[model samples]
Target chain A: MKFLCGIALIALPAFTFYCWLLLDSETFLSLLQESIPIQTQYIGLSNRLLALVPGLIPIALLMRGAWHLRRLFGLFAVRAFFHEEIAQRLHGFAFMLVFSVLAKPVAGALSSAALTMNYPEGERSISVTIESGDLTTLFIGVIFLIIAWVLREAHQLSKENAEIV
Target chain B: MSILVNLDAMLAKRKKRSRELAEYVGITEQNISLLRTGRVRGIRFSTLDKICEFLECQPGDLLEYKSNVDLTQ
Candidate 1:
């Protein structure tokens, strides 16, 4: 629920801008002419899709993982009323982390491919450099942060499983 | 790294069905089957405690430790 809400908050403005652009013709015409403000529509489509995809993925993964973990936690809840499978709990995070790291490059590659497909001419191509205020930055930042946690937990679980074995 | 769970033997001795134990432990019969076959990653302490309680056995009866045996290897 929180994840969905956060995505809504972040995506709301983009959508609002899109709506504002549509409702007000002069601003919309200016945006269309400028092309810089609307670059998000070009290369940013993938990033937008990613914000929706990845933002939702972690939640889905976490939910599925929580279901798998239900038995493990249920055991604890039934017994001491305080059961959390640390490894299983963190496993979803690890999945999100690994996905986030891979998603960016995958998104970049796909976006680049799409750009090439859409605009073959190098001069006509619409590609944005890594900028400070890019919307991609937010998604990218979230991805990086998730990856860091995933790596840490993954290593910890590996060591723990090794010890258990 | 080398503890062997003798769940099958203990369950056999207890004369308690796997399904019954599984229900009490809040795990599927497949998980109990995994335990019987010793194919689980790790059993929770709570699970071990529950199993011991159900079967009226010590942890030693349910599990055994053999030195330097790496079945996975």
Candidate 2:
């Protein structure tokens, strides 16, 4: 449901920039005077924001809802890879590991992009290179992968031992 | 992923020579029946070695390997 995030992905930065321009510097006039989206320059852009409002709330809620069920998803994944008994106990690790494998890096990229947009250019261009966020997310993903790998390996070994006994 | 046992053949070969081998194997005939039917999870190398010795057959004769293909379908 990455599309659930599409509107927020598009609008959050614009909304953030609009806010920063509105309230941050006392010099809203000069910033507004710069080449900008014509709609934003004219008004509060209320209708555009209103269009986003309905979509944003539900998507945010859905995203969190998906997060809440990650454990369930993990159990399902472990069950796919192993058996019911081992999978039930491995639910948390499986969820985190699989989630990390599948989505967290993309998530980090999106978040880092949002984070990048939040900051000012300052006297220098803000180094909001996609790589900046990608690196951290990649690190996290690898850790999760390793965790899943180690636990799964241990489980397989135990299952093998069970046969021996 | 690797060597898989055909305990059915090995057991059939062994139950003839010594009932003691069957008794000491920590498995009832019923459990052996389940194993023979390929319904077991795994086996120890020690058990495999013992079965091999009793049957006077190599482990390879008891087990075979092939590339694991998706068989769910």
Candidate 3:
């Protein structure tokens, strides 16, 4: 699990950079166009790349959350589930995920604004898209925070129990 | 904070070492030291019973309560 997260952490930035390159470099654009059907009207390279930033912001947050999640899993793998650090890492991951989920609308707005920035004033359009499925990810993040709180209480009890002897 | 463990005095009066008491009670000497120094949170009934039996003393002889007083002094 840790290995997979590490690989993903590395892969996301690389993939984002590749996409950025595709927006500018004809070579990567041709490669992507060959494999994927390009249905959208082609916008200016700078506008497309700028629009991509807001979407990439959420991915970056996810990468950070995944790093902490990986650490939590690593602790569990070593049977350190009761350690105080586990609760901290779990909470951090949860908050990051929650923030990422909540920022989705803002990201959409930013992406739209970036895309339409240079268009003639009357012609500019502001677009925002929402997908209902993202709520499930928000709920999962909340659940992680709840579990972390429970673990914190358990950790305190464990400490008291240890001192009993 | 007023509750105190008198295990050290009990062990002294019984002319027993903490190590011997720990062995007789089936616990580690480090725990015996903790109990003697009043550093532990609490003791298990089984462990308390063993200590009482091994020391040939009542539980009261091993623990006492005093009014809370200024600890800084």
Per-candidate fnat, comma-separated? 0.12, 0.53, 0.88
Give me the displacement of residue B42 in model 2, in angstroms.
Answer: 7.0
Using TM-score, rank the candidates from best to worst.
Answer: 3, 1, 2
Q: Tens digits of per-residue lDDT for model 2 on A1-165?
A: 334334444565556456534443334434422312111223333432432333244234334434434444544555654543333333333344344333433433343333334234641111212334545645664665566567667787877766653
Candidate 1: which stretches are off by over 4 Å? A1-132, A135-165, B69-73
lDDT, candidates in the order shown: 0.54, 0.48, 0.80
**lDDT of each residue in A1-165, candidate 3, tens digit only:** 888888988998888777754545455445434322232344577876787888687888889998998898899889986789999999989988998888776776776677667877775655555556678889999999999899889999999999987
Using TM-score as the measure, the top candidate is 3
- Return whichever of 1 and 2 wins on TM-score: 1
Listed in order, the DockQ scores are 0.11, 0.34, 0.83
- Per-model TM-score, in order, reads 0.38, 0.35, 0.85
Q: Give chain B TM-scores in order.
A: 0.84, 0.61, 0.90
lDDT of 1 by residue, B1-73 (tens): 4778888888888788999999998878888887787776788888888888899999889888777746655
Per residue, candidate 3 scores C-alpha lDDT tens digits across B1-73 of: 7788999888889999999988998989999888888888889999999999999999899889876764444
Better of 1 and 2 by lDDT: 1
Task: Say which candidate scores most in lDDT.
Answer: 3
Model 3 misplacement above 4 A: A23-40, B70-73
Instruction: Say which prediction, candidate 2 or candidate 3, comes out ahead on DockQ.
Output: 3
Residue pairs in steric clash, candidate 2? A163-B42, A164-B44
